[model samples]
Each structure stands twice: as C-alpha cells, then as structure tokens.
Target chain A: MNPAFENITSLRAKLAARDITPTEVIEALRARCTQVEPSVSAFNHLDWDTALREAATADASLPLGGVPIAIKDVIAVKGQPCTCSSKILKGHTAVYDAGVIERLRSLGAVPVGRCNMDEFAMGSSTENSADGPTRNPWDTSRIPGGSSGGSAACVAAHEAIASLGSDTGGSIRQPAALCGCVGLKPTYGRVSRYGLVAFASSLDQIGPFTKTVRDAATLLGAISGRDPRDCTSLDQPVPDYTASLEQGVKGLRIGVPKEYFIEGMDKDVEQTTRQALDQLAKLGAELVDISLPHTNYALSSYYIIAPAEASANLARFDGVRYGARVPDGKDVLDVYSRTRALGFGNEVKRRIILGTYVLSSGYYDAYYLRAQKVRTLIRKDFEEAWKKCDIIATPTTPTPAFKLGEKTGDPIQMYLSDVFTIAVNMAGLCGLSLPCGFVQRDSTDLPLGLQFIGKAFDEATLLRASHAYEQSTEWHTRRPVL
Target chain B: MNVEYVAKLARIDLSAQEIETYQNQLGSVLEHMDAIASLNLDGIEPTAHASPVFNVLRKDEIKPSLPVEDALSNAPKKANDLILMPKIVE
Candidate 1:
C-alpha cells in the first residue's frame, strides 16, 4: 500500500516494526503530492525539505511520531506563511507555532504543508479562497466544502496522512463529509485556539481530518487539553479518546432530530442518512425521534453572531501590523480603509460589513443581541435533547457536494449549504462527520456524511459511536479516485 | 441598510459597484435574520460565549515576551524598534 494512503494508526505500527522510516513516509507523500496536488489544489504551500528534515529526527515512539500532518493556513506554524488563504496576509509568515501545532510537534508530528481555505474562513465553500477553490477529489467539477476544504481534500486524496482544520460553523465537518473522510469538531474549549486566526472567537475550535475514526481519535487526543495561553480552553481532563473506540453502540440512544430531515432536502441524502441510522439500529443502537425545537432559528442566529464577532476580531488587520499593507493613504484612516479595500475578497467584505452593521448602534439590540439570546435557546434545546439521547445523528449536509461556481453568485445559497452543520457550532458541542454512504450524481459517486453530535466535552462517546458505525460499514475504506 | 456607512465603520473602502452589490445582498441576508427577530427572547440571557469562562487571572510575573525583531518582522513599516504608522498627531 502507498504510505500516503495509509492511516496514521497503521503507519505508527509500521514505523514501530521499522518496516518504513519517517523519511521514507515523507518522501512517499511528497511524491504522491507531486502527482495529485495539481488536480486537487488542496495545498496553498508545501515544504518537503522542512517536512523531511523534521521526519529524519522524529522519535517514532511518540504518539504521532514522524507523521506528516497538513495544516490549514489559518493556524500559525513557525516560519510558514499563515495566510488564511487571503491576499491580506499573502507574505506574512507565522512567527510562532499555534497552540495545536505546538501540541502536535511535541507528539512528534511533522507539519508538512499549508492547506488552502476560505479567506478569513468566512465562506462555506472553499471557493472563497484567494489561492483558488479546492475541488472535490471525488468529482473535480464539484467544490470541496470549506473553509477547511483543502485540509479535507488533501486527506481524502491521500496528499497528507492527516490534517488539522478549524470548525467555525461547520468548516471542518461539512468539508470532511463532502470529501469522504473523518472530520471531528471537538466541543468548544476542548482544543485551544491560541494560534488559530480568529473568525468567530466563540464558535471556533480546531480538530483533525483523517482517513478513519481511530486516526481522528489519535489526532484529537494529541491536540486536546487545557492551555494557559487560551483561557477559553476548558480545564477539564483530557480523556484517552482511542480507549473507547471498540465500545459498540449497543444501547446508546442516537437522537434523530426531525428538523434536520426537512422538506426540500435532497431525497438521496435523506435516504442515505436514514439507511445509516438503520445500520446503527441493526448494530443495537436505538434511534430515538427527538425535537430540537429551536433548530429553525440556528442559522439566523449564527449569521448574526459569527459576523458580529468576526468584524471585531478582524479589525486588527490594518496597514502597519503584520500582513500586506497598501501604502496609498496620507493618514491612518485612509491607509486602514484603502489597505482593507484592496486586501479582502468580496465575501470577506460582505461579512465584515454585516458584522459591523449588526454590532453598530441601533442594530445591536435587533440583530446581534437578539441573535445571542436565540443562541441561548439553541443551547438549551441541545441540553433538553441530551436528556433523551446520548448523541444526535443527522446528515452532515443537506445534499452531496455541488458543482463549482454553482452557488458563488448567490451568497444565501452558499450559506444554506451549511444548514445542517451550523447548529452544532451554535450549541458549542462536539460533532463528528464520517463517511456513511455515497450518492451517485451524474453517474459519479459523491460521498455523503453522517454527523454525530455529542454533548459539550463528550467527545469520547462521539468517537465511540462514530467508530462503531464506521467499522461496520465499508464507506470509510472507499477512497476518491484522484 | 446603508452599505457605505457600514463599510466606513468597518474601515473598508468599498467601490461604487461593491457598495451597490452589497446593499442588495446585505438586505437579503438580513431578511433571513427576521427569523430570530420575531422570536420571544425577552427573558433569555444573551450568550456572549459558549464556554463558561470569566476573567482568567494568573500570578503577576514578567514572562519572556517575543523578541522585538520577531515582533516587528512582519510590520509593513518599522523604525528603530517601533512600528511606524501614518502620523496620527498632525
């Protein structure tokens, strides 16, 4: 088997047996990248020399030792250009490692490449990337979901063994589902966000994209824990996520939210999702019909709350600081305005404006504040649902990956793409998307993702259920023909 | 609804075409927000953050800070250990 296609767990076993060295793995992946990366457009920047150098000295005994992990461009990796796939930070290299990178490095993982993403992680489709949209590996004509599209695509296409992607309103899970891989968005505060470029501070959490559920658990365990640098990181103890992988979902109640299977959703997606639930039931898991009454309001609340926070978080990108600065203005205000005008893409500007407007005078009470209150209701809905079920299962996306340029002209349509996944972020819970099945579109097999949401800080159960379902099915074994 | 005003508040200079485009797009996006606007959230407390964290304090001690050069490495314009911005006190 190609080392590039091998999951991290198997690679670890191989490395332990001395069947292959870390240097050989990097060399194999680099060769695979050379062959497939052009078609995938998954990476914004790749440094084989640096990755190889790290691999040569890697201690294979460490948990993630010598594993080449792709990093989404949003996270800071020392000496790497953490552009967030935007023109604003085109030449800005990270001066220090992000909190997750530091953790991964300490676990002996090699940070190999910078993956492409939405500019400032503002869009659902990776099409908003300044570098260009990362095409779905399954069908080059379709979009790989964003803002972690590159991270998901690279893993699916075997360009990287595993990659880290942040989830802010489904950036990680949605893309992972569309790309046919395992994507986990740990609960809010489960992973430190110190080095992650802020999009929505309250909603953002970094997790992993891997080829299997066990790999996801390994990566999540390595990167998760409290960090003094980020106070939002929970002080809760980090559990061994892999320890519970074999625990079958024999009596676990999986909540099926009626709102998630709504009218107008693609019939194929619903059928595939229902079939996956049936498979889980056959495996002895109970599918309880549940209602998250406030689900309808999650998208509206997220749009307001995320942008309001984004406008504030993004205010730091002025002319004098790090990143590209246009020097046309005579004064500070002119420079700030002119630099931003030329730097940001259309979607970014729209979000910034919407964010500013919502947080601005007169509109705050009506928009931002109201959205936050509605957020409280959304969180309460989850709290109530958890009483009836241990985990919530739903379609990761309403439909399979859509063709490129299909929704670019329509922003609302792009926003609607993340309808099923956004509520998980709003409630600040742990959500995992693994390959459940496939939908044939235009005679091509497009993958469908089944999302399993666990309560806040309850990733162990989430992984347990996901692993149970994944091992029972052949979907996770199926790879896109790149 | 004023696209230019919001752009000004955001410190971005939108082109006439962009302003026109955003005016229509923002209007429609906000129309979607009406879903939450009509909800009865009178007694619900607004959640500023999902994680229940307050002002996190640590022992007051000087820690190693980023070296000046590394801090200023990405600065657009720098002079003698200070980031040089446009003259503010003109």
Candidate 2:
C-alpha cells in the first residue's frame, strides 16, 4: 500500500496488520526530521537513538504503539528539559513526567523530541523563541502560529504523527488553525497542568495538536483523566473520546457567533468559516446566529487576569528557587534583580511587569479587580448563547499565518492574533480549532481554521460537530510539502 | 509611562533608543485596548475564573518534592550542594 500519511487510527491498524513496523515508522519520522529540521526548526531536543530503541519494543496491543509524537518544550517529559523555550531554564531537566506524558507512555507513544515554542509561551509567533524561530512549513517566510508553533508545524509538515501542546490563550488552536491541523483545548481542568510550566495557571491546559480529528481524539482520550497530583484537575471520569467519533452530528445545534464577524477579519477567512457552517448544515446540523455582546471586552479582561495570575505564579522563579541565577550580587535583592533581568526575555519581562503593575496595591481595583468583573460578563455571554445552541462556531483567527517578523515589532498587532480566541479562554469553555479550508493569500496558500466552542464540559458535542465537518471536508487531508 | 518606571518594574536598564521604541509600541497597544474598555457591561457579572468550586481547596499541604540534590543540581553556583547566589535584602 502506498503510505497513507494521515490519522493515527489507520497508521495503528497498518501496524497491527504487520503492514508497517514500529521501526519503520520511527525510521521514516527520523528521516523526515533530518530533512525538515533546517527548514522548520521544529524541535529543541531530539533523541533519535533512544526513540528507535523504544519503538523497537512496540507491542500491537497498545493503542498508539509505535507512533512518533512531538512534545512541546513547555511540558515536562521526565528527565528531559522542560525549558518553556527560555534561556533561564537552559540546563534544567524535569524530575518527573507530566501527567499527560505518563498518559502518552501508557498508550505506547514514542517521544520523538521537544518542539520549540514562544519564550515562556509569551508570543503569538515562534519568532520569540529564545533558541530560534520555528519557520512555517507552508511558507518559510510566514510563521507557523505559536506558542504551540513547533508542534503545529511539525505535525502539519509530517515531521511527526501527532504532538502534545499547551494552550493558555489560543496557543494550541491558533497554531493548529494556521497550520491546517486539529487542536483541542479540553475544559480548563479536563487535562492536568501539573507538568505544564505555568504561563497563566488558571488559563493554561495541555492538549494535542494533530493532523486529523481522530488522531486528536485518540490522544485526548489517553490524556483526559484526572490526576490527583493536580489540584485543578476535574474529578470526572475520562470518556473514550474515540467511541463518539462515529456518532455523526445529525441533530447537533451549532451556533455561529455574530460578534466574531467583525470588521478587519480577512474576507477569505470569513468566507471559509461560513462554508464550514454550510457543511455542517448539509450534515443535518442546525445553525443559529447568536450574539455574544461581551465578546468585545474579552481581550481586556484576559490581559488583566492572565498577567495578574502569571505575576504570582512566576514569582516562584526567584534567584533562590528555580531557574537562572546571577553569579555576582551585593545582596538577595541584587541577585533577584540580576537573575530576573538576565533570565527572562523582553516579552516575558514586559508581561511580568504589566502583571505586577496591575496586581499592585494602588492600581489593583482599577485594573485587576475591574477586569475580573468584566470576566464574569464574558462567561455569561457564552452561558446565554449556549442556552440556544450546543456549540458556537467562529473563525479561529482573524487571518491566516502572516510573514515572520511582520508583527513581532508591534506587540498590539501580535496580541490581536488572539482576538478571536482569548474570549473562549476567559469564559472557561472548551474549544477546538479544526482546519476548515485553505485560502490563497498573495502567492502562497495558507490554511484557514474554524473554531467550535462548547459550554463547560460540553466537549463531546463540539467534537461531534467538528468530526462531521471533517468527514465532509478534504482540508485536513492536505499536507505541507516537505 | 517613563522609561525609568518600566526599567525599574522589569529590573533592567534601557538605552534611549529602547525606551523611545517601547513607548510607541505600548502606546498603540493600550489605545487598541480602548475597544475592550468601552464595552458596556452594566448588569452582567464578570467571570474571574472557570471552576465552580470556590474556597473549597484545602489548606497548604506539604507533599513530596524533588530532593535537595536533584533540585539544586542544575544551579550554576552552589556551596555544599546548596544553591549559592548573590545576596541582598528585599
């Protein structure tokens, strides 16, 4: 059979039938990595020898046995450095595997390497990576969306079968949408954050970025269970996500938020997102035009809340506790100053300062407290809308991947990248961005993604609607040329 | 809005060029934030977090942490296996 470079289920079935071996899969992945590494810069660390050794031990009974998976550098992989793509953590290695990593191992996934990301998961593009930018495989000059940029790029370009990514504020979905893949952000506590380096603790959740919804589903099924070690983990049971894949969205109510169709949204992106709705309607799903008025305030609320939380979570990284240090200092304060100065990137330092400023005593109520007040409005916006429909749909991003460094110099332009996504995070809803179509921007083809968000703990319906759309569309089947 | 304020907050010193640049960048971003500010949310309550359980988390409970050796092993400067650093008062 000509190699079908698609979903994990078919790949696993082939492996079970002895049509493909773990070694062959690993070898092909490794060869592809070597060929694409220079162009894509996907991985920060790759252990090919160890990967081959582990893949050689494959047992067919394991669900994902022999699949080569990419790990986002921000998540802990026992004994590997969870650097969060920063210089401060250059030599630090994780003492234990994250809960998600443990789940991946239980399903027999081979850890291929650590993919690059935005430094401290701060930027919308991988260009802010302390190590280097991970170039978009679709068009080298354009960026692969970030901070899960490396995982998205690697999976989209076939560097790996699937990869794990963390989404704080659109980190997973934005990149997946930009790169033509499926990315899911399970409910805030649906997946454990114990191994994920804290970006915005309350907002950060670990999820998968994959080429197909099935692969994404398989990975989510493995990692969705609660971990006692993580306090915020949901106490609910993990459902077999794949079991619902065949349950088509015949009666699902999919809502299209009218607020998302705002000015400055790329016309092609809007058209494709609408086309996805038409596809859903054809599949017997009902489309309702819903209003989420509070959506306008989501970004403001997120900036205050996320930064305030980040400031507190990151205070642990003093010169004394974890990460980088200053060799020379007159006192503890000096050490703290120098360490923070030397360790964090400009963007990180900006966030920390902004975070601290908002949380500071004098300005607390005006900024942080007030933002918190607006946050409730944002969630209620969804609550009212969800009462009328099961899932809400929007274009994942305002536009497809833009050229590298095009928006890097402008922080607002970069923050605008998450304009469509930040609200979902604020409302504490579950969302997924699945590739819906490709748009020709200039001379290059950039993949456009459609986002579906569900009420808290309503991921099953979101998946059903998304899966049905995927069944009818050929967008997710396309791959970037190596 | 001054360079010195940002420098002190970030714990870094910047040249005139960097200060001038950040002012412009931050200025525009903050201006764009006006859109989010102008949102009229009179009767609606703001949602700060997603979780339903409130104040139910247990008191600080100590659990197994990495051994001192393992924790400090990655430090660049150490004394008697302790992480040594530049010293000062807060």
Candidate of highest DockQ = 1
| Predicted candidate 2 versus true structure: per-residue lDDT over A120-171, tens digit per residue | 8888888888888998888988899998999999888888888999888899
TM-score of 2: 0.94
Top candidate when judged by lDDT against the true structure: 1
For model 2, the stretches where C-alpha displacement exceeds 4 angstroms are A1-6, B6-17, B36-46, B56-65, B87-90
TM-scores of all candidate predictions against the true structure: 0.99, 0.94
Which lDDT value does model 1 have at A259? 96
State the lDDT of candidate 2 residue by residue for B1-90, as single tens digits. Answer: 454475566555445665677667656655655554555556656555787756546668898888888877667777887766654335
Q: How many Å off is the CA of A29 in candidate 1?
A: 0.8
**DockQ result, candidate 2:** 0.48
Q: Candidate 1 regions off by >4 Å?
A: none
Candidate 2: chain B TM-score equals: 0.71
